[model samples]
Target: MMENHKIAEEVIDAVGGRENIQSVAHCATRLRIMVNDKEKINQEHVEQINKVKGAFFNSGQYQIIFGTGTVNRIYEEIANLGLATMTASDQKKEAVKSGSKIQRAVRTFGDVFVPIIPVLVATGLFMGLRGLVMQDQVLALFGMKTDDVSKNFILFTQVLTDTAFIFLPALVAWSTFRVFGGTPIIGLILGLMLVSPSLPNVWSVAGGDVKPLHFFGFIPVVGYQASVLPAFIAGIIGAKLERAIRKRIPESLDLILTPFLTLLSMIILSLLVIGPAFHTVEKGILTAATTVLSLPFGIAGIILGGLNQVIVVTGVHHIFNMLEIQLLAQYHSNPYNAIVTCAGAAQGGATLAVALKTKSKKLKALSFPSALSAFLGITEPALFGVNLRYGKPFIMALIGGACGGFVASLLKLKATGMALTVIPGTLLYLNGQVLLYILVNLIAIAVAFVLTWMFGYSDKIKEEVEK
Candidate 1:
């Protein structure tokens, strides 16, 4: 482990040190980095690192793909170096200053969350599958569900998926702390505080009315259960505090004292500042969503449908997940989530259209499964393989998705329960009018088909026009 840590440090230095990084996030096997300047990033040098599998860029981020088990350690080393700064280049700086309030909020969310998509998808899939298995009686009898499945399937997958959310903070804290260069142990403590059952609710007040909570009579912040932003902000602050304390503490006691001070300061700040601030931000997101969905159905559908593709491209789709799940838990049906489902259905149809129209055997073969997988709510395969490659299919999908989204919103289509997959998941919204949902899905697919057929698949266009 020590030797690996040394190599990780060297890799950071070779990639122009921490100063070059604006933000860092990882996917299934790739470290997605947004740098201060793309020119400053030495891609060749990054690829040369011993454990690095490869490096590439897409959607405005530089990605370093790593073999299994290597990225976590390297990410830790990068964070330890204190290079993750939020500052942007002159162009981005001006955009930040000049952009409208909504634009700024969207950009901020993107900056913080885009890099962490792989983790979200993996864990979501895990959770979804676990729900599927546990809900099945056959699997329930086994350890997979109840540790007694008569079937011979192994139950380990059940344990891993079912318990992911319970320990999710530890995962987020570890990742956020690695991004900020803090001790994982300290992050674990802060994460524990957010999820700890012993913590008192802020809503309780002396006169039987709700009131805000305070931390040690100093900072005022709210509880953070199943939250993302607060813990991240706290982790960064904690890392910085640890570094400052480390510089002043005596060498013999530095190890113990540094963490002690850092943890206390971070907890105070989190409760008082970070947590409440993010709560406000969360409210803002909710307000915006409510306002938009209140508009006429057609306009709402068009905007959401059109933007759904853009949202996924930028990797901010998970923000919708928080709203969908949380609001559904509260309200039993969410208009926003229903629109998102419509958008997914649109993508599925567009991809399927491209698959059918393409003349190239290779393209057709690849797109078919991609479309099917996307219909099942796994989009990356289709997004990267078919729609993106062909370009026009994606454009068609966006337009159709927006149209579908608007219609769904207009109709006030709401999901009664969460879905495990986007397509089959749309069934969650079915309320006796299963035919209406099916019709809506079919309409989106038909629009996508017409658009793709008119535009022509990339491969077919090249072949016919060139001929």
Candidate 2:
């Protein structure tokens, strides 16, 4: 307790003292603090502080990296010291408002989806494992035909792998509601109603097992499963509408009437209008993605693979998960993940080369872990902390990723899931193309490493060390 307070005091001092802070928040890995003035911050002193992994200013906040658990303790101490604390969602809203329209839209996409990533990660792993177990070779080894696996086992794996996506609307709606200031539980309930058993399952409608219900013998509506855009739109409407309704309703009836009216209106509007309309938009996005990916000679892959990390630097890459998940849900495969994995490997590769060639101990210390983290599908540390700081390395990594993505697309490589990549990403390719996956990774790493070593680390390396 005392140590946390001491660290908090040091951090506060480093950032030009408590008086300079306007608001503060913490997420899984960083202390996100908004200050009244950036000039007052002693950047060098903050970097030198103990228990600080790294620090950088982005989205109008000076975010100090603290790995994981330590951040919460330090944040608690700072709050106890009387600084106003913001929720993670509120912090995202603050950050999103600082950007240009396109950047703000991207950040908004990230804010809506970031909270749900853990569930997606778990679903991805489960899908990978299920694929591994169901392979023909695995079945043969067990002295069974494709049909021989126990029905019970298959059903159990479905529960693990499909539950999240099957009810994905609920999850997305719940998170979106929280981020947008609606009652999250109400958001969840509204989302559930969209996929209620009373409505035909979306898959059943698509597969011809059941028909979409018609209203007044004309318009048709159905349940939403593995759908994102609709759930997202519904959440925003539901949240804003609830707030507006509450403002006019009297206090005596507020508690009961507010929720009742909010859900009732949202339910009818979503089923009769929002779901069908947004579902079409989602399908168009899915089709476009598929068409572009299937373009001759992997041109789209090369271009996207190269630019994806660049997009990450702008904090917009989180939007790609939507594409990956949509592909997986509709097509039972995700070539996008395969291409992006190569891109991720290239980031690590370039960072590793910089680490190897750098003369500065500070650069080396920061680059190594950042490189490894990139390989494991987390790149902020590498992108923000090391690669972007050196212009050439980032460009070199981009070129390398293009080459890797080209190879992946040409080979028609696919992953069983989304989210996991590189080392842990191996689970995604366990359907017997392990060698192909490894080859793609190596190609990316090798290209990025050679390019970076040859030209990425600049003459400024020694100058940084001297400072």
Model number with the top TM-score:
2
Q: Rate the local accuracy (lDDT) of all candidates.
A: 0.62, 0.85
Worst 10 residues of 2 by lDDT: 458-467
Query: Which runs in model 2 stand beyond 4 Å of their true positions?
Result: 1-18, 23-25, 42-54, 66-97, 100-104, 458-467
lDDT of 2 by residue, 1-467 (tens): 89889889989998989889888999877899988888999877876666665688877789987756888999999999998899976776677767578877777777788778788777777877887789888888889877888899989998998888888899889988987889999999998998899998989998998999999787788999889888999999999999999999999999999999999999999988899899999999999999999988989779878998877766668788788878876776889888888888998999999889887677777788778878888776677666766677778889889999999999898887777889988988888777899998899989999999987876475356327
Q: How would you encode candidate 1's per-residue C-alpha lDDT over 323-412 as one tens digit per residue?
A: 654343234355665566667777778888877776866556566766776677766656655576557778888877777776776677
For candidate 1, the TM-score is: 0.59
Pairs clashing within candidate 2? none
